[model samples]
Target: MTYQNPKNLASIKEISARLDDPNLVILDCTSTVIPADSGSGFAVADGRGAFEAGHIPGAQFVDLERDLSTPSDHLLFTLPSAEQFGNALNRLGIGAESRVILYSTGQPGWAARVWLMLRAFGFENAAVLNGGWKAWTNAGLPVETGAAKARPAASKPFSWTYRPGFFVASDEVVARTEDEALVNALGADSFRGEAPIAYGRPGRIPGSVNVPTSSLVDPDTGLYLSQQQIEKIFADAGVKPDAPLIAYCGAGVAASNVVFARTLSGAGTRSVVYDGSLLDWSSDPDRPLVTG
Candidate 1:
């Protein structure tokens, strides 16, 4: 089956060929998340060290938590204001005519998050590198080491157009209409509250359907499943083929993968990521959560 939105994904071959395109801006959006020492949740770590060790030639590293997200004392990966995001893009030399490709050394979710952010900010020329760094290396592609070279400025300034509905708040999730589906992108163990680790609470948002991001990719290849396979996964998860979906996870990172997967599957469905997700929901005792 053909992808519903083919432009959202880039193949390793396409990326390899475009390595020297003046308008191409490749970003390594890798961020490692390790289990917190306290043993309850996860902590975000900069992927610069890994990128410095080796990366796609001419590709710059993006610290998602540091470069793109807003500063939050309690939450991780909060959405940055349009101005802040625009400035970050400027520094990276992205412009109106630029083609941005995002990839991660770890989970594809890290790269998807940045892709979602760019989409939300009205940048339409960006795509996520399928299979990310794993596929690139497994294919024996050339790698570069050392810090990223300073990016030359874009010929034209990046125009910011704030789009609504790409990200929703907790209240929006709470007030979701019946036509909408609330999907949890965390693993089944977390969805069932059986996992030893949790963001804040051990349960899922009340009435959420499970569609873990991990299920969207081929385990062995680190590439997304075929379009037909992904569509079936969503249908099996109780999501109506045409229903709008509100996807959420620990701190809204994994949910982006869900959103991206839905697009890649050619499901032609509208999906939005809950910005705060479980981290925001569980912090408030008044909110309700359910566990199997």
Candidate 2:
């Protein structure tokens, strides 16, 4: 039986059952993410090579860097416009009536980023394949080797209507200081400045609390912790369920997982990822950063 879990998660079994749905659009968001400490000067590694090598049946490759981000002079993690994103979706055979499922080979953050992006653009009928590629293979699911393929018929029309307010900037974070709680989606070391190697600077936004993406997921399985476990993790950090939150990390990638977790943690909390993150925050001489 085909089924979708809360927070837009699709079990491998659910997707396997609906492998023949006409309007089902599956995207392989598999990416090699090099962290800030990699010294490569780029946070994201090219994932096309992996996608082109082998992918799930009826899956298309979604290039996060080239397709989702626009060229900018400054080194910031920014998103593309509605038109640009729409065109990318169309090229992948996605349309208004499609149900998109995204999955990745690495951490859930990569898949979550794509899901969060789709929601920001007003398409909420998308899910991340829980447990990702590993889970599928572990479960002995069949796989196809070769180039990417789109599930929807080529003749299907594609479109996207933009919806705003899925992300926050440094200015807005400052403006909403008193209202929204800020969560640092980084390891405890990075959150506490001990892992300065992971970021440009050694501190965090003054009031942000630590909620490492690693904690919300199981490293061995790539599956998320139960909703109760996730909520307790946040609640233990003093994050209020009813209040809004902002998630940030070294380059804003891990923050996506936190936002996705909040999406799954039930409706009382709404979280937005700050794309620029601490890299943008610490770059400004005037912004304050704190460390223990």
Candidate 3:
């Protein structure tokens, strides 16, 4: 039912059963990519549009930009403040006891954002739909179209509570750079500034390992790999799961996808996301940076 730790994961059937329960809230976190060619843009749009055309009867759409992230900043989906987040949750009809199952049309990036945010606010019952929406739809479950009313009410009041073992800031990663055990969740190209795709400057933090976040998922299904599979991925990258990991992507969003995978590996590891990621890391001239 409720999962407080990362190690716990549910199958499509189990999550589906929970979705059938009226109390559980299924959130479709399929993101609308700005550039549209990043990865699964068209598919994500189709899934969401299809959801609007027909979803799991009561599922709600959680737009990555509008519902989960702030509109002011362009660096990426950086987290919102506690009050702002509470307001968003309230508008979504989320309460303290709400059981959320976050599913994305793409990989875990979008779902992971909501999961991390829920954990950050100390909501203990949130779970990410394993394999995301694709898995459910592939199973040939029922679908619905058109917007539905918010059941009995419009909004639910909720208060923000700080959650430990949930999130990490950029300075924390910088502090751990000297430890020699930390792994960087960015890609080889961006880590070396060879790609230079980010809005700010490129290049990764000093002494960080290059473990691209995309490596954790199945390209076709957009589902996370098995625990053993992920272990091998990390091992192939020369990373030890037992060590403390600080997952950081361009701006902390993508890295959370990696964190979700690592959590399912049962390594007794805690992965803290570097919230500022490359955006804040590159902006400051004083911070140490390294390139391959």
How do the predictions measure up, each by TM-score?
A: 0.98, 0.91, 0.82
Among residues 3 or more apart in sequence or in different chains, the pairs in candidate 3 whose N, CA or C atoms overlap within 3 Å are: 53-145, 54-144, 54-145, 55-144
Tens-digit per-residue lDDT, 205-258, candidate 2? 988889998898778898888887887898998888787998999766789989
Off by over 4 Å in 2: 1-7, 35-43, 150-158, 267-269
On the 0 to 100 scale, the lDDT of residue 134 in model 2 is: 88
Candidate 1 residue runs with Cα over 4 Å from true position:
none
Candidate lDDT scores, in order, read 0.90, 0.80, 0.68
* Top-TM-score candidate index: 1
Ranked candidates, highest lDDT first: 1, 2, 3
List per-candidate RMSD values in Å: 1.1, 2.7, 4.2
Per-residue lDDT tens digits of candidate 1, residues 1-292? 2687889999999999989898999999988878877879888889999999999999998898998999987788989999989989899889988999999976789999999999999998899998999999999999999999988899899888779978999999989998899999999999999886787889998879999999998887788888888989999999988899999999888999999999877664589999989998998999998999
Clashes of each: 1, 0, 4
Clashing pairs in 2: none
Worst 10 residues of 2 by lDDT: 33-42
